[model samples]
Target: MDLHVSRDFLRGGRSLLPRQWFEPMLLAVTAGALTAGGLSWLIGAHDVADLCWILGTVIAVVPSAIWVLSALRHGHAGVDLIAILALGGTLAVREYLAGALIAVMLASGRTLEAAAQRRASHDIRALLEHAPRSARLRKGDRIREVPLSEVAIGDSVVVGPGEIIPVDGRVTGPPALLDESVLTGESQQVERAEGERVRSGVVNAGGAFEVQATATEKDSTYAEIVRLARHVSAGSAPVVRLADRYAAWFLPLSVATAGLAWAASGSAVRAVAVLVVATPCPLLLAAPVAIVSGLSRASRYGVVISGGGALESLGHVRTLLLDKTDTLTCGRPRVLDVIAAPGQEPAEILRLAASLDQLSPHVLARALVDAAHARGLDLSMPSNVTKEPGLGVAGTVANQHLTVGRHNHGSPSPAWACAADNRAMLDSAAVVWLTVDGHLAGAVLLRDPLRKDAPRTLRRLRSAGIRRLVMLTGDREEPAREIATVLGIDDVHSNLTPADKVAAVHNESAGAVTVMVGDGVNDAPALAAADVGVAMGARGSTASSEAADIVLTTDRVDRLADAVTIAVRSRRIAAQSALSGMFMSLAAMAAALLGLLPPAPGALLQEASTS
Candidate 1:
């Protein structure tokens, strides 16, 4: 739990304001009245004891009556009706201490509900915080910084190194090295030549360059994603609590039965007995207790369920929609394996390739360097290093010439290198070719590896009653399908924008409870749109985490299965407690109708059963 939430829980599960402190204050007053009344009766002041008990009961009844009336005015009736009737009926019969006990139980229930509902508002600001606020506008030979709104379509914008692209545009002068991972979920830098289109929100990974804007800032891709997120969040329906749903029907049944008891016996006392016995304490108390237990258990397993409502819904999830990038894969490129040609060694090829790649700033270059370091290989410094913009890097290392990059398409590659390329394509991995002394030596294959526990997690979800598994991603068809195939996913939607992901979620959620799990800014809208959004929050973007109903706080994907298990078990326990309590209440109500039980003793019996 967050430190602020922990403080709120300790303070009667609500704010410290007087208005919000009603339930806890009422509980304290009720306890004081019970203690004072007992002492007064023991000292032969029976009248004084009755007054104390009456005062406590009235103080508690007034607010509960008002709340009941307010709920009725909203066209809803809840279990609070039973508590109000029990308090009033006990007071009418002068059973003061019994009324005081009812007040204590009612106040306790309200406090628990208030505490369980303590949560911060959904954070929409995370989506807009990263938006480009300013752009470098190039006006006919003079470049100046301006608000993003001032850069109109057809204007020239200068994107500096490490700066985010501010608008959708086409590169103008030279090839630009851009990282488009935010847009496409591809972990490699792309070289965009003159006349090639580029989307907004990508970072310039190389030297500064100019682009001809084809869209204004508001009309760009990032802005559209922000707009979609806002739309989905606004349109999402509020969760109806499980206790409230049961209260809707249970309230009417108890009221009608009590009315019948009064008519049949022609005595107000009989009706009071019926009302006392029918107070739904189990729904009020046991349900919230079970949900809180589930939330705590989930936290122990590295999942943070937002509230009782989300926890209850998790028990009923059937279809799970997954995002491809960080949800199922490692989200970064890594060296998978190396292929060596005749008379060449794999270790020697990787060492030369990594050594030559040390000075490059590309994402794939870093992957090679990390791979070499992982193997504890000592690298030689390259003297005379040079890059061929869109091709590869070349240098001299320890008296040998080395070149590392993609094989030139215009030139013939060795048969062995060609064979390696074919294998890399089938595996959806990138191939980096290394040439030593003017001959092709080897190839290094790189890929975003699937999470080690992903397979086991899927099986556990099936055991926990997930009926369908689908994947949605901004990645291309080949890579997305490959992952889905490996994981045995039933459906795959590839190359999706934020809007497309939201549409997919809506489609999946039409007649079933759907869970969308993701870990990127691009998933924020869909996270808000799904029936239950689960964010991989340990390394996920803040936007997606804020929009989700449940968050896995650890990097372990298997903990999600544990969350579902806890939800299902908690709900079962709550239902069992409620049903058994209701059965006992029915028997007590029958006894009261026959005049075998009275109001005060019946209230005690009901309280004991629920407790």
Candidate 2:
């Protein structure tokens, strides 16, 4: 609970100022009058034939009944109205305190509802305030602070030590290292050379590096996540058609049954008794309270579910369609394994690749560095380096012409075609062709590893009632199928464009609620198309967070199961609360119909019980 909401509770629930204060004081006064009337014969305070009790009762109870009806009715009658009519008319017959107490109880229920609602709104405000407002802008030899909106593409920016990069920029100069965990989830500070991309909102952890801007302000990934927060503020919920139908029937049935009891008994007291227990305040407050509590639990696990409706709908979701990149894997191309041409030592081939790649930022270059580090080799400095984009780098190590790159991205180093028998070994790694002293040496292969938690998360979702798990991606069939198999996913769709992804989301959602998870521009449309859109918060800076229904802050597939569990719990709580209130109301109606009580005394008993 927020401090501001607590203050409001003090002012509204305790003090009840302005018009609210008047009603409570008025009701208490009426209660006093009823007590006097009930004890009139003993007190001897009034003359015989006096009508003080009847007059006071009419004055106090009639308006209380009307106001109570107005508070609960939304253009239609409800069980609460029965309590009002029963007490108001009977109060005219000299029972005043009964009506007053009921009014007070009704107000108390409303106060509780108002405070809970404010607390939820305050939580959202606190979350949005965490986003940064200003960024450090860099222009050649001139460093200035500016609003994030002023940043533009193609401008060079200096990301200094201890400062956050404010816009997406491509590295134009080498640095010792950069901490990109905020954007890429890589544990180590990604050592940067030239021509590598860096996103805004990432912390600089090493020596200062100059980078040319690629995207800025609204176009940056951080800006997009903030936008996603805004869209999910209201939360997705169930269609109101069913709730409307329930409301229509409950009120009429309650009213008709109360009328019949009064007509059969020929006593206004029976009708009053029925009305005493008719109010649905308890049920009305129950559902929202449960939903809010459940949402708090979800926040602990890094999933921010927007509102009561979203939680309720999750109880019934059946199928799940997921986006592959960034959702299941690291989303960065890294070295997975290494292979050497026939008769070549794998260790020698990797050392040569790392030596030449020390100066590059191409996909293959990072893979070589990763491979060397895994083998406990230090990828320090080498001499006479000539690096080029779309071509390999040239360098001398041990008097050898060492080059590392793609036949396309890396310069064509001495080409060593693997003997036919050894070619099969290259398939497991993303082979980066390498050469040394103009002689074919070997190739280094790279791959983005699957998320450490993907398998476990998928299993939990299945246990939690998610029937089908589908993986959709722009990656080729083999990689997509490989990931699906690893994660125990049911269906795999590969080589999809953004438009095709949206179509797939709709297809999977047929007759079931679909949740689509992704972290790139290509996944935005599908996120919007699914019944529930979940963004992997850490890497989702690139995706349209605005389209997602829930944002997974920890950015893990495992949290999906946790999110579903929370939603189901919330719905269950709401249902239990609503039903409990309804059942209590019915019990009151049954007591009233038995002709054991009158409206005035019944209202007082019900009000006292509630308070």
Candidate 3:
């Protein structure tokens, strides 16, 4: 077992090395070096200290040398070139103790990096491992446990109340309240009746129901999220050191400075001291440290920034874009209007429509059922039921030939259901047709409810200095325009394909950073194409969330403003920290050149003052 662990460590040390081991080692090395130097000095063992320096220099220089050579051979501009050059030069000049101190600190920094990655990877892994395994399958006269992939469409799967629905299917039982916050971005429990489509991963709240599988396990919603989280996490680039960018020139520049100092001072030691003091640790590490610090702060607020770079860029965004469905609105259709026929009681029409509509699997149908339930109205059992596609519904209720849906504009109206394309009128109303004894009764209009915070969030962003707000949607023009008017969006582009949405994000976007927000399959591409994509209802779509730079765990658009606010704060903090480090480093560099301090004291000032 020990051998296996050692082999694993050797094989995957760069990616898999755990922090508990290395972090302690760094502390031990740092403590040991400081103690050893003090003990040698107390014994007045200058030769011993010199000998210790010799051994440490050779030991440290070998690895740093090898790392530099390998980095160049592989055509890599090493991430820590400035630190490496400064440390290597210090050791070569017999300043072994300074080299040891810097080395231990750099090692600790690596441990910090490893710890941060572990936290993020752990979150992703936890989500993947906790996904449900088996689904309840109903067979002839008995329910059986079966592999999820083996279940086919139209096969009844019994999902117990409070269990995660294993796959997408049409409900074949009584009305159920489903918590689809993870599937959609809303906090409310959704109502679903028989024949209504129920997405996988939604928890059945109170009533257990039989759902005919419409999609398999591999094609399920959770699976898609797992896929997206993995895809969107492509490695992010942390800010590279400015010193490294100048290292080629800085090296030549440092060499010239040292030569000029020595020629003016007539001492090579002062020249070496100049090289030792120009390490650039503060310039290289301060921004990354500040970024990580900001990320840490964000995590406390329940926000997960993918990395430092995302936090940096998100801080500077000037434009905000939103998708209408699920992002700005509740995304659930609810019964809104009841246009009853002459002398037809509104209560009677709704009760009748809700009963039969409960047996149909449609978005609008579920809303109608919920509205009736809210009014304490009950529907009678439907008889001679015949649900014609797109014509709405027709059946014998209380021995009356009742029909529900749009008016038939042509042909014979099923002598019952039947729409001839004329039923599609009233484009604004979410309407459902009703028929009584083959007679057209009336239509019930249904519309999606608006989110309470959307208006305030939109208004606040403009006050928050957002230069423009654009709304892009895959939905039709009329509803989109209506939504735009309600939200007070500055720009609206409706009826766009996923490709079109991506293209639209590209248009009028050049230098200014744009943030796109959405929560659905259609919004995935646009999310990826934007400067920063914010996914709403992230618990629902792993792909969209993963594709987005930011993921909101709760299905609320208010988090959009919160995320922007947090990012801006983080970026401001990073800039301040970085510039402060630069100012200090520059002052120390100036002092070293003026012979104000020797090499050892200069390195100490750099590390101690910066920390």
Top TM-score hit: 3
**What's the residue-level lDDT of 144 in candidate 3?**
93
Q: Is candidate 1 or candidate 3 better by TM-score?
A: 3
Q: In model 1, which regions exceed 4 Å deviation?
A: 1-24, 39-45, 69-76, 111-240, 335-424, 430-446
- The C-alpha stretches of model 3 lying farther than 4 A from their native spots are 1-27, 53-79, 119-122, 136-215, 231-236, 241-268, 282-286, 293-307, 335-446, 463-465, 476-478, 537-547
Cα lDDT for residue 374, model 1?
76
Q: Please give the ranking of all candidate structures by lDDT, highest first, separated by commas.
A: 1, 3, 2
Distance from true position, residue 374, model 2, in Å? 16
Alpha-carbon runs more than 4 Å astray in model 2:
1-96, 138-143, 153-214, 231-248, 335-446, 541-543, 597-611
| Model 2 per-residue lDDT tens digits across residues 1-611 | 01011111134355444533444455455555555655774677554213445544455444445444443453433444544554564454444445544544544544554445546545455445645577666665779878877777667777778777777666776753766554444466767667655666677788787777756677665566556555443221321222233446666666777788879988665665666556555345556556666665665565666655666667668888887756787656676545566678888788878876755534346557656766777554668988543346888877788777544324443334443213424343344667777656676656667878888888888888899989987655777777788788899998677788888988887778888887655577888888888887654544446667777765567777888987876776666766666666677677778866555556555555554
Which residue pairs of candidate 1 clash? none
- Tell me the TM-score of each prediction against the true structure: 0.62, 0.65, 0.70
For model 1, where is the 10-residue window of minimal lDDT?
Answer: 1-10
Rank the models by TM-score, top first.
Answer: 3, 2, 1
Question: Candidate 1, residues 345-397: lDDT per residue as tens digits?
Answer: 89988999999886664446657877887798987777798866335688999
Better of 2 and 3 by lDDT: 3
Give the range of the ten consecutive residues with the poorest summed lDDT in model 3: 1-10
Give candidate 2's error at residue 62 in angstroms. Answer: 13
